[model samples]
Every structure is written in structure tokens, then in C-alpha cells.
Target: MRLNKVVLMAGCAMAIGLGAVSARACEIKIGATGPMSGAATQWGLAIKGAADFVAAEVREAGGLKVGDETCQLKVVTIDAKYTAEGGAAAANNFVSQGVKFVLGPMGSPEVTGMKPITTRNKILMFSDSYARDAIGKRWPLTFHMGPGPAAWGDPIVKMAKEEFGIRKALTIAPNDQAGTDVAEVVAQVYENNGIPTKLEYYQRGTTNFAPIVTRIMAANPDVVDTVSTPPGDAGIIVKQLRQAGFKGAIGRLGGPGTEEITRIAGGLDVLKDFYWFEPVFIDDNVRALQKRYHELVGVEAPENNFFFLFVAGGRALAEAISNAGTYQDAEAVAQSLRELHVNDPNLGQGKWIGEKTYGIRQELSLPFGMGLIRNGETLPVRRSDAPTDE
Candidate 1:
């Protein structure tokens, strides 16, 4: 989890029921909701791919263990179209389908909208998105798989102190829950660390950022952490930053995690002057997955997103089901999940922490990629090399 550097291959298909299974006993009706046809559809599409892959892989391998039942995980994908209403509808459908376990609908509002449904039905919802006030209560069945935007903030500052000699920083985020949340967390840490922050927020989709740009530069912080979509939108902010001629050092919430942002910007080196967060590790197991994923999808996987995270999440569910030893009691899956633990063939060991209310804290191991943006690329600036707040 703390190491990087990769060269990997897919592993042999192993026995499903200890041999190799195409299908089997228990049927786990799990649902995944996402914006399959909206402006923010990229995330949903990636998650759909990830969930599908995980469901197939796990089911083929005999299914997960729950107490003593080897229940097969059956994933049902629902298109939310990036609307809270759609999410609500999707959650209702899942509940009707008797899906006691569920994944996500891309970002924040979806997670917030589905809460009533998940909570009412006692369905456990796991999201690749950050935590919000609606999900504020740690329900017995909801868990946030990814860290809040703030996840990378502390480490970015830590690295700044050690590497950039930065005591002053400017912060930018779209004026939304995800954006503001990341800014708040970062600002808190910066203030706590005794570093002054030139914090600013803008409407996420606003066209002209000249004013914001001018304001940020005027404050003149040593570095900037532009928090926005891990991909698409964040690019706009960074592009504006460069155009405005303010280039000290920048940290992005998850900019490097998006291949398009990197490729379009020219190369990974564009992020060379910025700090970025990586959702999954490129360990041997993960690399093996990447190879197989590419082979199957014919498209190289994005570095982050629910694309791979869902597979890891599905596998985690499978392991829990395997440990449960039975599949009859849907509610009991959490207990079974708690009892089982394995090195996620994707994320890493000890990556998931048990939080019954929120299911599993899917990625307990946080490995953020701190890189510098240069020539329109992100190069390795440094790595946190530790979990949580390194």
C-alpha cells in the first residue's frame, strides 16, 4: 500500500467454490446507481464497468461467504442521470428488488438523496464519493468508501512544509458540498498547522474565473490546491490558473487520477507541479486487474473512480459472504463482513475498516500522489507514504 512502481500480469482464474464456479447457490441482489446518461455521466459509466466486472469475477469464483452461505453477488445497475430524483427512484427500485446492499450514484447529491431509502429499508449503501451532512449520521448501513475532499489536504500541507518550504497557501474549490468540504478540511489543517490560507470558492460550472484567479494571485500563497471533479472540471480551473500566470505549486484533489486530464493536458507531467490523490494502489494485484480490465474492456482503465473501486468493493462483499457461511440473513452480512478480511486484490490490506452503520470504510489505506504540474503534466512531487494523515 505504501509502495509504488509497477509491472504486473493477470493471475490464473482460480476455483470459485474452491475450484472454479460459473454460478452457484445463494443469489445476492445488489444494486448500483449512477448517472449513466447525464453531464456527469463519466463517473457513472466507470462505476458501471467496475461493478459489472466485480460481479462477474466474484460470482464466477463461487460467490461470497455469509456466515455459511456462499451467496452469489448479482449486481443491478440503475441509471440515475445525475439527479436526486433519479437516485431516489433507483433506491426505491433496489429496495423493491430486495437489494439489501448497494453501491453508488457517482457524487454527492445522489448519495444524499438515496439516504432515506437506504436507511428506511436498512439497506447498506457504500459510495465511492465523499461524506456529506445528509449522510452525517453514521447510519447502521451506510458507509463512505472514499475520503472527503479533505483527505489529501493534510498530506499536501505536510509535503509542502517538507518539500516546498511553503508556509502560505491558496485554496480553490467549486462552491458545492464536495468542493467546500475539501476546502474546509484543508483550511482547518492549515490553520491548525499555523499556516495562513488564501481560501476561495467559485461556482463549479462558472465560465469566467478571471476574478477568482486575480484574487488568488493577489493573496500570493506559495501553493494552490484546486479541489473540483477529479477530472473534467478541475482541468478548467488549472488551465485558468496557468493562463492567469500564477504557477508556484498546485495540489489537485484527484486531478492526476483522471487519464483524460493528463493525456489531454499532454502528459502526467502536467500534474508535476500539483499534488493529487490516487484512489487505488497499483500493487501487483491491482496491476493484474488493470491488465485484465484492459483486455476485457479494450480501454485502459482510469487511475481512479469507481471503475476499479467497485470491483474491490464487490470482492470485499464476497469475502464477507464467504465468511458468513450462509446467505439467508441479508442483515447479517455486515457481521460476516466484519469477521472476514483479506488483502483486497485491488486496494490493499487493512484498506477497509468496519463501520457497521456505514458498511465498510472501503479504503482505510490512503495513498495520495503528490506531484508537481509542469508543461501541462503532473510529475512525482512526493508521496504521503503512510495511511490517514501522513
Candidate 2:
């Protein structure tokens, strides 16, 4: 009896030791990189917040299952500072830490910079950037979070033209790849809609837009488009344009930042007439995501609507990881992701597109919305169906 009791205790001790070892071995780290500072800070925060919320949700549901072992999901975030160099450094950091999956690097320049590192290291990435080459056939492991201007620009431009009766338009942006790429696409859309357009660029860090505003006013454009300009810069440009006695409607065919722009430009009244692209249509279902995020993360989600998009993307990544049965094999996980049906409880159904523009069908096309502020009164966001390769 004494020998039997001793043997039982030894078995229990061994079981507990193996359990601890298994727990440590099954930790999966996901890397989230974006511009966590400067004017684009809100965009970056959305990426981090989405990853954090997804990690928490997985933990609350008894952890993520990868094959036989239940794995704990951990998010490791880095601020790419909205720059090319920053993005490359972040990718190197992730590789050194053995992180095989990545979530962001939101700006065009950052995506361009990070692609080489991620591709070389066989890391899979889901990125949000308006650059033309944000995702392509060369980088099979890279995916786009949503459609860029090339997908949704036409309808929004046509709506603006019909509603406001704008004649000629001018697009202003920073003189960088992030700006030029989106600006050219938006400008082409405006011109396609029979509205002649001109392109203007300013140094990225230019705080005062007085000179640029003067140049814009010289053309006497009936509408001015702030394509791909950072929200902070857009607000200043809008305020200066209004102050200079320009009564034309303002357009933003770039990323969503209406909240930040309104606050910086004083108020909606100051904006007068404005039209911009909203990434997600804020219906009750979408609003419910905020509640879930708060419940799991213990804080309010970032105000940027990009947060919702990232949440959808993050959940999809988790599913792919589980399906592939290993986070270490990025190619296998990428294959799993490509086979996903693109459905989300909150965001509803979506599809993978982009063969025509990017020469690859890796872009996630989800329903989007357009915001309008006429005579200082904000209207309901108008929903648009997901785009196709056509």
C-alpha cells in the first residue's frame, strides 16, 4: 500500500510538469505593425486594437485550437511611424521574435517597405494601403484588407458630381508614394466622370497650407479633392480653403478620417459641403462589434472604422491558422486564407477580388459606405455593395 501511494504521487507530479511544458510550447504570437504615432495614429491604433480584441476573444473562448494542442494567442504590436524605414525595421523585429504572421503597416509607403522583408522571410501579411502595388502576384503570401480607390472611386465621384453639381476638380496630397498613388487613381475617376481635374502636391510635413491653398484657389476649381492626405493635413487644408473664401464642395476619396477632420477643421459647419469614403457602413450589426470589443478588451475600440475591418481580417487569420494546423507554416496558412469564404458575423458577406487591378485576386471586397455633409448637416451613410473584378 505504501509503494502504491508513492507511485500515484509521482504520476501526478509528472502530469503537472508536462502540462506546464505544453502550455509554454503552444503560445502563438501574432505581429501587428502600423503607424501608432503622428496624424495617422488613429489608423494604427485600429490595427493594434483589433489584434488585442481578437486575442482576448480567443482566450475567453478557451483558447485557439491548433491541431491537438490548444494554443494561447498573443499580439505583439510595433509602431511603424507611417514611414518606409519604420516598416522595414518592424518586419525585422518580428522575424527575430519568430513571428510568422503579421496584420498591418497601414500606409502605402510602409507596405512597400515591409513587403521585401516579409516576402523574403516567408511571413504572411494582411495589409491596408492605397498604393497600386499593395498586393500582387509576386507576393502570394500578402493580402489586402479592403479595396482601394480603384474599386469604389467611380460611384462616389458620380454621386458627388450629381449631388453638388461640381464642374472642375483639383486633388491635393503629399508628394510621396502614399499620396501620388491614390491621388492619381482618384483624379482619373473624377476626370472619367466628365469633371476635368488637376493634381497638386505638398511636402508631407508642411504644417501651414497657405501657399498650397493659394495655388489651389488660383485654378478656381469648383471642387477640391484631398486624396490620400493624412486626416490632420486634410483638416488644415479644409479650414484654409474655407477661410480663403472658397465655397466649393470638398471631397476625400481616400481613407476614412471624417471624425478627426471635423474636429481639427473646427466643426461640421466649417466643412459646409463634404463627401468621403467610409470603409464600413455603421449599421446595428456593426455597432454591436464595438460592444463586443469593449467587453473583451475592457476599453473602447478605436474611433477609426478601420478597426472593424481589421477585426474581420484578424478573425479570418485565426481561422486560417487553425485550418492549416500550424502557424509556423506561412504558405500553408496563406492557402487556407485564400480558401476562406469571407464571411463575418458583424460585417456580413464579402468576396476576394483584385485580379484586374493588382493582377492578383487577394483583395477582400466588403460592403462600404459613403458619408455626406451638406449645408453643415451630416446625413446617413449610404451603403454600397461589394465590388467585383469587373
Using Cα atoms with residue i matched to residue i, what is each candidate's TM-score against the true structure?
0.78, 0.94
Per-residue error (Å), model 1, residue 376: 6.0
Point out the worst 10-residue segment of candidate 1 by lDDT: 1-10
lDDT tens digits, residues 12-50, model 2? 112464364222446789999898999889899999999
lDDT (Cα, tens digit) per residue for candidate 1, span 74-190: 779898755567778888998788887777766666776787878788787766555445244455556555455454556656766665677887778766665665576667767
User: What Cα-based lDDT does every candidate model obtain?
Assistant: 0.60, 0.88
Candidate achieving the largest lDDT: 2
Candidate 1, backbone clash total: 47
Candidate 1 residues lying further than 4 Å off, grouped into runs, are 1-26, 35-40, 62-71, 81-83, 132-138, 149-152, 254-258, 263-272, 295-306, 325-328, 351-390
Which residue runs of candidate 2 sit more than 4 Å off their true CA positions? Answer: 1-25
